[model samples]
Target: MVPPAVESPNPQLTQQFLSSALSQRGPSALPYSEDTKWLIRHHLLSLTTSFPSLEPKTATFTHNDGRSVNLLQSDGTVPMPYQGVTYNIPVVIWLMESYPRHPPCVYVNPTRDMVIKRPHSHVNPSGLVSLPYLHNWIYPSSNLVDLVRALSLTFAADPPLFSQRRAPRTPPSHNPNPNPSPNFDSFSSGSSNPGAFSSGYSRPSIPPNNYPPSPYASGSGRVQPSPTTTTSHHGEDQSEVFKRNAINKLVEIVHGDVVGLRKTREGEMEGLFSVQGVLKQREDQLNKGLKGMRDEMEGLEQQLQMVLMNSDVIEGWLRDNQGKKFRSLENVEDAFECVDVLSKQMLDCTASDLAIEDTLYALDKAVQVGSVPFDQYLRSVRALSREQFFHRAMVAKVRAAQLQAQVANMASRNQHYAV
Candidate 1:
């Protein structure tokens, strides 16, 4: 099955545009790819949105020769000034089979007479408009809507009919030379002309291309177009595009500033958080130290309390028993007489006990050392002990008296307790 030759975005006008396109474009029109069809539909849709005067429809016309062709174009009316006069001009953008790879072609279809000459740099007598941007087109980066906007700006600068050519500059004449050397032609052979030798070589003539400076060229051969002629091929340049680029750059700068400010604030917050953490740690350590010190202080206080209690008890004991007196009965002289007798008896008893213990120890030692027989030594010790025992009994009676006198003296003094 043969695919439809024309794809109309606006289905209502499809039949009418099909007839028109068949008549205008040839029978050999190529079938559009899916992408090309989509771009055309999109271009038409955008034209309608931007230019209310657009008649968005696809058209094809079948000629009498039994041939059908498709014209891929979207027509619109745009307000423009020509020769200092404003008029809404009818325009059309045609998409070829090789679109996207090839730039879209434009035509300024005037409603008026065909013979009327319009002074436009890019729009010639045939109504073909050449755009510099289209000449420098790169697909995906360049869109139909942008192309339309560029058209708008191109019209805003000196539009087609208003831009006229200035007078052509005439070349300066260097024809008549009064002092012509006849032998100048002979200068081709350096040694042939004597007159050519007398006169130095004549200055070289300047080329016509160099004499008349091309509008695009300066002293340097670089093609530098004026700002007004940036789109001279399309009769005007796009100042709006430059302005838009500048605005976008400014927005980027502001965004960068905002990002920098956020980073600075985050850094400051981080610093503050670190400081707070350090301070909290220090506080915890100080509190722990304070708790330990308080515990130590409490222990010291308890020790002091115990010491004070002990001291108080000692002081009370001293206060109660430091000085005291005892009341006793009579018979003091008798007690003194008894004490002297008893003391003399105690001294005699102690001496007898010592002599008995010494004799026993000496006899035991002599027997142990083999100086005497064990039986003889024992008999000698027994005799001495019996004599000592008699003396000890007498001494015991004297000691009992002496103890009684000591008790009397202690009662009189009364050092620790009251009597």
Candidate 2:
């Protein structure tokens, strides 16, 4: 007899196993971030605590893109409650590299004696499971425990597997006849050879009584025999039996083809979803770049406006003084006359300060070249700096007075407008 696939929960063992798998380095390392690995370990531990049947292990998972990754897998059975009794349904859950953010891949791992029920709402012919919980998986909130619970609940409503029925064995007759008449039973059973049953499809080692009652069984809790087993050449025409067998074979072929096509389509769809996620990330980046460009364009437009205003002021000044000719330096100074006494004082102070600065620079250069003695250069610099200080102080005072005057003028204009 095969050992039960599920075992009791062992949190300490589970943790140790996960730690060992996750800590592997280099080529054998799990392809998960440090934080993700931690989360995976925690999630598995918690899941095992809740459901002792599911055990964590590592497996190589190949994606639709043909890339193989060593991912953490949880394989065992989940206890599903049906008709007042609980049944263990074998399943394998693969945690993808992008788990938490994306849902894990789940498949119904039926045993040799079990066959996946066709037209199953949640499980596909290829054993892939689709659940609303997986579809609505939310990161940070969804966990392995909850997912397993959902699977159990969904499967309890509609079980995914049914026990495969084997060909019935014929009972030996004790009647001592010299020769046995040929019949449909003898031909169907191939009774000439005692090992014919073993040569044919191998049946489950477990007795029929040990098998769970199939969910597809009728009200009497007995599975209805197939048409081939119930109908015989003795009761039905031989031509009809051959035709039925041919039709069944054709149906099986078509079902297999359909299942293959469906699996291919599902793989293509998964690839498309991955591409869509990549496209969504790129779209977010493009949107951010476009926003930055828009902000930069606005700043540039503002600068351009300021430049245009400054250009207009310079152009107006050039137009106003284009024909005015200065006869001497004094006339040139007069042409750029200040508007007020404070403005005139600021202009004079600024010009005197600049002149003193030039004299100091010349003295420094003269000292550097040894044209002027260091003592004389120092004395001249001291005197010029004293004078420059007074000029700069005067410039500051005049500028402050001018600013105050402008404030008063603006206030008076506002008062007049109010009146």
Candidate 3:
């Protein structure tokens, strides 16, 4: 069927609608991030600008997982060239939550009179479209306009839908009444039912010129019957017609309410999911902090144990020296003996190094005051420096031995604690 021609949408209104739908805070707001929303707006505008036949709008999308989300949708027809003739093929493009990162979902939105062509590689019976471009979609590069163009080309090669043939109606029997009034059947047949159309709008299989121009042809691209063409049934009971109309109105109201409720619930779910993500991040941070605190506590405990052990050793040495009394400075020096032979050697080397440093300082002072000659001063300094170097080397070796001994002692302490 030849799709209805769509008029160019008002730029200001289009922008306004997109802004409202993609607002950060609102019931109608999309789930896209701020940057993504801007990209979506730009992509939609670009598409409509390039192909005026396509119109952007918002709709509810239901996933296979039974989750409902409000998403931006482009519902309209794209121009496809088939066998030297251009035809408009209706389509719907759904921008998912992770759009641009992920490709948009395209579908062949066929009208009620049309049926999907089976065994098609690009299109499935459920109207879901699969194309090479979608498979290799790259972010910030692939866009809605290019996707629509690809769809047009692919559809041109093999159309996704074909018109469903209907059997011809038999001619009505002749009535005896000279003034024949329209019955219920005649009234209903002529009346336009909105439900008769699907996939947004309907298109005639024959040339558009053969039928009357659609009331919405120059407007929103939707097909609506003209008011003038709507005729009242004179023969049918007015009360019965009113009852039927009232029931239909009630049903529509109920349907609208249900849709609104679903959308509200879906919005709540999205909010909850966002809160959950925040909570998960905080939980991870807390866990990391707790582990760090535990490590710090263990280090402090180890330091306290080492300090206590040194205190115990000092107390034992004090007790051991409690009975000893020194009569002279030499005896005091002998009383405070080194803990081991290596410790005594380290102490002797340290003292000799300090003595040499003092001797060098005295020689400098004597030379400055002319008490010592320059040559003598130089010779004395050289001799003192050589002796000091040997003492420092011995001190370094002793310190290395002490460090290794301390490391061994700590390892033993750790092993004891483990036992």
Candidate 4:
């Protein structure tokens, strides 16, 4: 029969499958648990250790230009002293091959760019810290963990780059040339455009007519129209005065518009607040239900995780417990077997004891019959007693050997908990 031809995979389908796989994989699922070489694996964090909040992208050990220098990525919490208050700071320590012999290099991993360099006390231009402990590091005595702790203390005396970047202090109160308001008197500078120098309200221009004394006067209310008034003599009519007064009146309209806007906003806000109370009550009811369900779901998820984690510990405990019980039972069974064997050995001893009893009975019967001589009977009795005594000694030695063998076997098998 002819072999069937194999169908070739469609390139489009292959690409689609790959894309779906990548999407579902989702950034390695647990980045820290990937396969690594033995050298790198040895330095990786244990189950007991807390992982760094900001770990390097790759956990691989870096080699320095093919030299013996190997840099291991380590990150964890370090105790920090910040202004009389102690805080835990995260740091990265690089371990080299000549580890205990040489102090590991350390850096503050605050997770953002900061003023890394000097006049910055402990920290060097390269971002490497120079703590007193690091400078005089004794090969075997000085460790990386303590060195990082010292760097944290150093930061308090010299605040970090970000700490110095606080909001600019409330603007200085002193101003040599205090501008009370825009000088509308100078039209060229102030009235070039309405928007110029307009911070909320514009300064009103000074009126040329300082005539009638009014109740709202800031300074001398009426300056009797200058003795040398020119308007009348220059053929300027009352229309000119009327026009100037009207222009001044426009400034009052600006103030009126501002007041109207403020009132409209306040009224609108009051209406919304009256309606907001009703909506807030309804929102609380719905939110309570939604939040309760969400919390229940989260609680269930956490409970399941806890149970699964406990299962491994439980299994280990059960296995060790079962093993100990089995060993104990085996020892008991062996003891029973040994006792049975010793009992069987003692069968000979029982026979010897019975023989002694029989010899006495025979001696009693002889004395009653007066058939056998008293001397002969006494000689037989002595020989029988001697034989019985010999057998008892031999049996005792054999019984001891049997017990010793059983004890040795148990001790060998249960080496750790042997009695």
TM-score for each model = 0.30, 0.43, 0.43, 0.25
Question: What ordering of candidates by TM-score runs from best to worst?
Answer: 2, 3, 1, 4
Better of 1 and 4 by lDDT: 1
Which digits, one per residue and each the tens of the lDDT, describe model 2 over residues 1-419?
12244446667777889899989999998888775576677778877866677889888999889999899999987766556545677899999888856999999987655567777899999899999999998655577877887887888788887654445333346535544333424434434333442343334465643434544331235433322212111344578546645654665566568679999999999999999999999999999999999999999986685566557757988898898778866655567766579978988899999999999888889999999999998889899999999999998899788657765765786799999
* Model 2 ranges off by over 4 Å: 1-7, 169-419
Of models 3 and 4, which has the larger TM-score? 3
Candidate 3: pairs in clash: none
For candidate 4, list the clashing residue pairs, or say none: none
List clash counts for every candidate, in order. Answer: 9, 0, 0, 0
Task: Please report, in order, the local distance difference test score of every candidate based on alpha carbons.
Answer: 0.55, 0.73, 0.74, 0.47
User: Tens-digit lDDT track for model 1 on 1-419?
Assistant: 11112222454464455444433434454456543454455445555544445565455634459876564666765544333333444577776666755787777764321111345666777667777878888653455666766676676564543111122222335435554345543443333343553453432244522221221112334332222212222432368456645544665566568679989999999999999999999999999999999999999986685566557757876697577533363654332221255566776677788888887888888888999997888789778888888778877776566556655755665764774
Worst 10 residues of 2 by lDDT: 225-234
Candidate 4 lDDT over 1-419, as tens digits, reads 11122233344553443333223345432222122222123223220021222132224444557633223445544433333333344456765445544555666654321223235666556556567786687633344434543555565455432211111222336645445334332232324343332332222233423211221122332212212211111243578546534543653465467669989999999999989998999999999999999999999986675566457657876686573445556465453332365666766676676778787788879877997788888887788879877877867887677556655754675796665
The lDDT-based order of candidates, best leading, equals: 3, 2, 1, 4
**Candidate 3 lowest-lDDT run of ten:** 211-220
lDDT tens readout by residue for model 3, 1-419: 46555667898899998887887487656788775677688789878876777899888999999999998899988776554456677889999999966999999887655566667889998999999999999766677877887887787677776653322233456655544343333323433343432212334456633322221132224343322212222344678557645654665566568679999999999999999999999999999999999999999986786677678879999998788768766655776778888899999999999999989999989999999999999999998899999999999999889767866887898999999
Report the alpha-carbon TM-score of model 3 versus the true structure. 0.43
lDDT of 2 at 256: 69
Give the residue spans of candidate 1 off by over 4 A: 1-30, 60-68, 81-86, 113-119, 162-419
Pairwise lDDT winner, candidates 1 and 3: 3
